[model samples]
Target: MPTPILVIDKLHIGYGHKVVIRDLSLEIREGEFVALLGASGSGKSSVLRTLAGFHSVMSGRIVLEGRDIT
Candidate 1:
């Protein structure tokens, strides 16, 4: 949407050797007001963790403010 300020492609997240979330992708436009809404265990916080680099991405790319986080 109108160009993205942030992007996630094929993101895979896991704890240790176990993969909990996989193949996630998202795009956030500049000034976009967004919410990570879902039921419990929907990987909403997992995505945020991956973006913040707290959780290592098994395979994927994360771009934020023109910088690649992964």
Candidate 2:
């Protein structure tokens, strides 16, 4: 596929030793709108925090505009 607007590869996010998000990979295309939906405390905000770098990404790659973000 053509390059995505955002690409997340094998992401692992956590706080301290407590893993919140792991083994997650996704791609968002331009003009696409994606939402994080889940139960409360199920890491929806945690995922957002991970992307915004507020939370720790234990492992993974985040690509934006063909640049690696993490």
Candidate 3:
């Protein structure tokens, strides 16, 4: 299999002192379709926003195309 185009490893996202998402890891390869499904206030948007560089992650790594973006 080809290398993943995007990789999120041990991602930890939170607001202030409260963590919204913890240890979130994912890998998306070329031509792969991904989706985030969850209830309201489930940190779905937080994850997307972080991926879009909208928010800062508390701790973790965000890699894209073999480069670390976080």
Which structure among the candidates has the greatest TM-score? Answer: 3
* Backbone clashes, each candidate: 0, 0, 0
TM for every model, in the order presented, reads 0.83, 0.88, 0.97
Clashing pairs in 1: none
Better of 1 and 3 by TM-score: 3
RMSD of each: 1.6, 1.3, 0.5
- Report residue 22 deviation for candidate 2 (angstroms): 1.3
Badly placed stretches (over 4 Å) of model 2 are none
TM-score ranking, best first: 3, 2, 1
- TM accuracy, model 1: 0.83
Q: Score each candidate by Cα lDDT.
A: 0.84, 0.84, 0.97
Give the alpha carbon lDDT tens digit for every residue of 1-70 in model 2: 6669888899888878888887999999877889888888788897887678776688998888988878
| Residue 47 displacement in candidate 2 (angstroms) | 1.4
Full-model lDDT, candidate 1: 0.84
| Cα lDDT of model 1 by residue, 1-70, tens digit | 3778998888888888888787988888987799888889888888888777787888989998788989
**Where's the lowest-lDDT run of ten residues in candidate 2?**
47-56
lDDT: worst 10-residue window of model 3 = 61-70
Q: Considering lDDT, which of the candidate structures 1 and 2 is the better prediction for this target?
A: 1
lDDT of 2: 0.84
